[model samples]
Target: MPIRLATTADLPAISAIYAFARTQMAKDNNPTQWGKSHPPLDLLKADITAKHLYVIEEAGNIGGVFAFILGEDPTYQQIDGAWLNDQPYGTIHRIAGNGKIKGTFSKALAFCEQLEPNIRIDTHQNNKRMQHLLEKNGFTYCGIILTEEQAPRLAYQK
Candidate 1:
């Protein structure tokens, strides 16, 4: 699979991937993280227009999507726990797979790492799968950070 910036043409596939991810989360007992309409079409469109959205393509189809923003995230400004470092970092958000391919997170992480060694991510406390993946990938628990919606999420850095 190859990762590349997403364009408007990828919206339908991206939306489908998120929908599948939401269902998977529900089955995994982590329903509320994305709820029913997270990463809404408008937000995803904004990400694409902003050039922050990327898609993993396999066999000419999109298998995964994610947002890689290289800058400080307002939600990460205040944390109940400290970060690994104060250095410049990238934030990975809205990562989801369409179930056709595995290792989406690992592939995304590797791609992001090539750009910035320091990366930050946050997940809902109930998202055990995400937490495990983060831990397994050498990410350390940083602390709790509230999302823009004021929902608390477990933060991590690597």
Candidate 2:
């Protein structure tokens, strides 16, 4: 799958993936995470315009999405746990995936090939699937970060 920057026009697809993510979060009883605010339409649009969204595509279909930012992740900076590495690095945020296709994690990991080594990311405490995926794909459990909503999230880096 090829990963490219996503546009505002991709909102529908991205929203659909968030809906799927909500279902998963609900099943895990994480009612405060993506389960609470889905589609994140406004945030989506903002990220798109900032040129921070990335999409994985194959056969003309979008499969996964990721957004990242540089500098200190405010949420991350306040974490109670220690970071695996203190080195400055890019922070990968909101990696949403549509169950419509597999290999989303692999596609996300491939993003690493384009940048520096110390990449950071976080997952909902209840997002077991993502936690496992990150671990399985070489991400080390770093610590936890509190979201703007005041929810604690498990953090990782690779």
TM-score of 1: 0.99
Cα error, candidate 2, residue 121 (Å): 1.2
Top of the candidates by TM-score = 1
Global Cα lDDT for candidate 1? 0.96
The C-alpha local distance difference test score for the whole of candidate 2 amounts to: 0.79
- Cα lDDT computed for each candidate against the true fold: 0.96, 0.79
Per-model TM-score versus the true fold: 0.99, 0.89
- Model 1 C-alpha lDDT per residue in residues 1-158, reported as the tens digit of each score: 89999999999899899999999999999999999999889999899999999999999999999999999999999999999999999999999999989899999999999999999999999999999999999999999999988999999999
Candidate 2's displacement at residue 91, Å, is 1.6
Q: Which residue runs of candidate 1 sit more than 4 Å off their true CA positions? A: none
CA shift at 53, candidate 1, in angstroms? 0.2
